[model samples]
Target: MTVVIGFEGSANKIGIGIIRDGEVLSNPRRTYITPPGQGFLPSETARHHRAVILTVLQEALEQAGLKPADVDCVAYTKGPGMGAPLVTVALVARTVAQLWGKPLLGVNHCIGHIEMGRLITHADNPTVLYVSGGNTQVIAYSERRYRIFGETIDIAVGNCLDRFARVIKISNDPSPGYNIEQMAKKGSQYVELPYTVKGMDVSFSGILSYIEEAAHKMLESGQCTAEDLCFSLQETLFSMLVEITERAMAHCGSQEVLIVGGQLFVIKSCRFFFSNLTIFLFSKSVEFHRFCIDNGAMIAQAGWEMFRSGHVTELPDSWITQR
Candidate 1:
């Protein structure tokens, strides 16, 4: 079986993973948690990755009981992410590949998530709902490509949630989204938020703006608690996600839906939506947190797939992009 080591520092998390064929041998990651009322900065996040990536890589190798020489290839996320973070991980991957004399693969971040979801859940040809801090899209495989059927016109869903969390000063230890989800469970009131979905795309900036203003007014007037606002935001946004996913499913004529990305963790908790569809939620239990957030295992898996398909990237072609 082909062995691969993957690096992922797309946003706030820095991860290293080792995989053999489709099986993940090790997955180690660290998230850069900013304080309440703040969001992650690319420079700071990149510095965090640069500081801890080697430690994370060593831990992954130790966990897998493998040496640098044992790995057949090295992979790193190449695009659709924060530039500084992506470049940080890419430099590390390139250094490791050079040191070990291993082939290097530049993987599309979105494709990595989709490939890992497919590997973990074995959901063939399913409509995909890819939601994360940096991305939100409904995708389907067509002619060897994951085509975007729908997407966000403005900020991503997770970004909106994170920014909203900042408005209410929520903890960012694990994630702003997870904290919101927990607080929402305690919420009994539902505040109305704007819902904007135009054709196949969704927009979150308007909703985010509206909620920020409403939360401020409500807090000032003693009309609502943070929990109530969190609950309302989750309900409104997740309902929109469910609606769009169903629309994509209907258009693609697929019975199975694969939910992947950091936001999938929150979405999976929406039992009301899963009950209505044949949903294949990846990394549901095993390493649930790792898979839910961006991790090296997905990158390793995607890289290995590309290697098997005879794809390799030279150092000259290893530039990063934020699409």
Candidate 2:
């Protein structure tokens, strides 16, 4: 069996996956998010990664019934992630590759997230909607590169959510997304927030400020309930994303909409609304939350593909992280 190990440490998640042959021996999985209270501290994030990277790797190898030497290749995320966090994972990968003398591939974090669904679902040439703290874009595979049709001009969706949660002082446990999602669920009313869309691209920086202002006013005046504010924020931002994604689909004249990212899993209400889009749009593609977050499985799968396709250098010194 061809065994490949994948590592992903973009943003707040540290993920590892092992795939054998063409099948994921173990589903692409992640350990957990940032610690309680603190959220997205770069130093803390790097430290957490270092603490668990080896443990998770060991668990994955045991689960796959394979040792490090049994790994035919080592694939790890290299870029489009928190630079310090990526270094933590990449160094581990580098060490493994050196010790085992296996082929090491530096995988793009964004591409790995996007490719996760493709690896799990075996879809080809699907339009991918990647939503996360560090990235928000609708990508379509074309030519030799994935084309970005629509993306956030500034501030990603998850980042906006985290900032909003902090503004409201929600517990950062589990995640800002989970905390905010709970708040929205508890919400019973809605308040109006600014809705801005520029062509096919969307902006959330302004939205965050708008929510903060509205939330501030509500807090000072005691006019809007926290539930109302959270609901309103979710409504406005999700609408913007749905609108842009629909527009991109029309522009591409394609039907597939594969979503890849972490926060996508938490926005159940938004996903429900996005489902309504299917009634009007054509041929809704697979939108599985299995690879919802960036993890090792996606990176491993992408790296293995690259290795199989002759897209990577087998030499050890040539494998460089593209942070």
CA-only RMSD, every prediction: 3.7, 2.7
Write candidate 2's Cα lDDT for 1-323 as tens digits: 56778888877778788877667765434444554434677678889889888878887887778777788888887787777788888889888888999888888878887777777666666677788877888788878889999888988888898888888777766677767777787777788777888988888898889888778788789887887788788777777877887777787766566777877434455465556557546455534332475667788888877878876545454333534
Q: How high a TM-score does candidate 2 get?
A: 0.89
Worst 10 residues of 1 by lDDT: 281-290
lDDT of 1 at 146: 83
Per-residue error (Å), model 1, residue 212 = 0.7
lDDT of 1 by residue, 208-229 (tens): 9999878888988989888999
Ten-residue region with minimum lDDT total, candidate 2: 282-291
Question: Each candidate: what lDDT?
Answer: 0.85, 0.75
Which of the numbered candidates is closest to the native, going by highest TM-score?
1
